[model samples]
Target chain A: MSKAIITRNLTKRFGDFIATNAITFDVEQGEIFGFLGANGAGKTTAMRMLCGLLKPSSGEATVAGFNIFTQTEQVKRRIGYMSQKFSLYEDLTVKENIRFYGGIYGLSHQQIKSKTEELLGKLQLQQEAGQLVSSLPLGWKQKLSFSIAVLHNPSIVFLDEPTGGVDPITRRQFWDLIYEAADRGVTIFVTTHYMDEAEYCNRISIMVDGKIKALDTPAKLKEQYQAASMNDVFLQLARAKPGENNSSS
Target chain B: MQPIVIENVHKRFGDVKALHDISFSVEQGELFGLIGPDGAGKSTLFRILATLLLADQGSAFVNGLHVVKDYKAIRRQVGYMPGRFSLYQDLTIEENLNFFATIFKTSVEENYDLIKDIYEQIAPFKGRPAGKLSGGMKQKLALCCALVHKPAVLFLDEPTTGVDPVSRKEFWEMLQRLRQKGIPILVSTPYMDEAMLCDRVALIQKGEIMQINTPGNIVKSYGKKIWAMRADNMFRLIRDLRAFEGTDSCFAFGEYLHVTLHVPVEKVQAYLTPLQHGNLVIKPAQPGIEDAFMQLMQEQNETV
Candidate 1:
């Protein structure tokens, strides 16, 4: 019931360039939160800060009940992250990748073996566990990545465009796994350019020009903008005239 | 002759069967859509129709020419824009368009009108590297290069996926204008709302077509008792109403939680008391393409 992630004026800057301006938001426990924006809209920056990979410039954020500035290690320990291209080692078998990820998370040998079985069973990848990851289809690779991310049983998992180029059916099946994770009380924080995938999140926060433009349930944001769909919600807030270049704020 | 037609199509990549006995025909001058999420065989089907890939077992024709037998002819009559920015990112916009035009044995001046409307927007920046352009600009450039050849059938794979909403709207408008020229356009999208923009769409999932219907007909076929409810605390309202006896399905749609009734609407009082007391406004609602697709998905799952 407590806030899994809370931010106050969280900002991230690379040199003088502000990737994320002074922004504030909170992600609740067990909520599937969608962090959305165009390619360079600071969603990734904010998420990196939460994941403890990036520190804020002049703000504070608490992720997984740990102060990001002082307790980054604890924050990292309690959360999982899957990047946009989080494919497992292609040459390794499916079970091997799970074991590797499980090992990195500090699970015991027996524990890793059991969890590997568990993940394969959940993903229906048990029969293909011995096959090389490269041989598996992209859809299966996505499921495997998520399985490894959550195999450690982290309270919060961050997924960045986990289904970027996969087919729609695979994307749908991948989302079903995400929903299952949330149902099991794993708070999901995900970023995606796919508007339809954004709709799958319980609530979405849209970023434009390094600022949070709209933050609410996909439905609420759609109505507030009077747009027909999330794509419209994004359009209304992100409509910059031609020649108006974003100053990389 | 149909601009595109597929009969008993089957495709596989290695051991993975990507498309199953898929069959469909797209008429000339129609804005047909292939709607699905990832891994729905939309791309596979597009590749087969484009004649860029061969179907393990099937036959297809584009503009009355066989895909396998007359691939060279089909290539000349099709404009294919892949989902990704598959153009030469290092080249200038003008260069990319010119390159595609030249490949078709044509010149920029030859088919300038085909791309003029889209090109005008980027004319000043024509010398800019394609990669330097914004998502919207890149999208317009991709369209220009694809159309510079002035093909009869245009295939766009999720053309508006990553671009902003305004550009998506603009891109669809451009397609409509091209349709006026009687170019049979085929586009794919993961977003359900875009389905409404097409004349007819095939709702596909898992290498199969769920429904092939006009978006209007798809929404109309969802003959369910639907209502929209909203309040200051809409999230809580959704949670609370889901437990209401008459509530069958409650999905967040637009300003309200679209609630489908398990019972008749006249017996609404049994449910509205708690909702009204919670300061929520409830009204009857119409289903959209998404709702239709979702219902169809559930029905398909139940049957399968």
Candidate 2:
């Protein structure tokens, strides 16, 4: 029930283009939180800040109890991130890639071995462990990327549109892993353009034109806004654009 | 022979094997959907069938023409809309449509009836550059160009990704209308809900076919009671319910968490007491296509 993420009036500005307007929200420990938005909606910007990759133009935030601005290194050590692209060296075998990433994260050789085996086994990747990362199929790569992201047993993980262009069946598999991790008390923060995926989150926040206009469980937000689905909620806020009312009760 | 037949096909790019032993056929006039994510090999399969790329090992046919041997003939009968908006950015919408039609040895006037419905939606912006139109408008134009020749088979890769909801719905509606013409359409999408709209779907993962069935049969195969529930402390509710011994699998579904209870619903009491006096709600429900996919994945992992 503890807050794993907290942001207070977070803001990001790039040459007067308010990439992320003043926003406030919190994510509880072990919760699967979906960050929903249209393209260019600043979902990426906000996630970058939380991942310790970018600094907020203003405001304050904490991830895993580490100050986002000053203790980013500490925060980085406690979290894992998977980008939209299942980024792994295409030439490296799955096992090598895991070792390299785990090594960079300072995992001990023995620790990396045990974790790799466990992950590979759980993901049904034992048969493909020796295959080059690029040789593996897209669905395999996606699952591998997620496993690598959380390989070090980070307290929280961030996924940036991890299911952007994969099949529904693969996305479903990805979510099952996410759920499995969440069941083990790992907090998950992900951004996705897929409204259906948003429904899988314990709570969701919709960003439009650099501002968060809706935040709640998908149902409450839908009911509160008199919308039917996440898609409707998105359009209702997105079409309102920059000058319209942007907050919900 | 089917309109489109892919037999034990495989494709690779450098070290990346995009498709592996994928085999399926599209019946003439059927709406076939390839449902998968960005890298599920949807594009690779589409390109192979469109004769833009060749499979490494297997054979495929469009209108019973070999994709490799009859590439030229296949090209004339298939229209492909890539995932990205790839029309000439500088060409006006109307110009782009005309150009595409000309490439197929046809004219806008010749196929006006075929594309008239979609074309009308963006007609106002026809004189504007293809890049200048909104995402939805651009999508409509792409469809028009693809249909200008009225090919017997059409290929659309991730056609609705990043587009607005209304436009997504409208685009699908247009596809439905096109189905009336008896053209076998092959569309790819990462979204599960859209799978229901297709007459049949091929669910792929890691470049392999997972299942191929009509949407209705797929739903019928999922025999689980899903319940959606929520309360004031939604986060707390999600955790407590997930932890309860009898709970099978719980996921956030819209406003409530879709949960599977091993115990009877009337038995909501034994666990309801601990959750009582707390701000939460509980109820039983049904599974959507997405839910069924999750269960299948879960089952696959347990056995694998």
Candidate 1, residues B228-248, lDDT tens digits: the string is 777765445666776778777
lDDT of 1 by residue, A4-93 (tens): 999988888878778899888999999999988775567777888889988789788899899999998999889988876755899999
lDDT of 1 at B79: 94
- For all predicted structures, in order, the TM-scores are 0.80, 0.73
Q: Which residue runs of candidate 1 sit more than 4 Å off their true CA positions?
A: A1-18, A26-32, A54-62, A65-75, A89-94, A113-144, A162-187, A193-204, A214-233, A244-249, B223-285, B298-304
Using DockQ as the measure, which candidate wins? 1
Docking class of 2: incorrect
Q: After superposition, how far is residue B72 of candidate 1 from its true place, in Å?
A: 1.8
Candidate 2: tens digits of C-alpha lDDT, residues A1-249: 788999999998887678889989999999999988765667878999998999999999999999999999999999999986667999999999999999989999899999899988998889988989977767788899999999989999999878766655566568878878888899999887677778778899988778888899887888998987888887777652322221110
Q: Which residue pairs show backbone clashes in model 1?
A: A167-B38, A167-B39, A168-B37, A168-B38, A168-B39, A169-B38
lDDT, model 2: 0.82
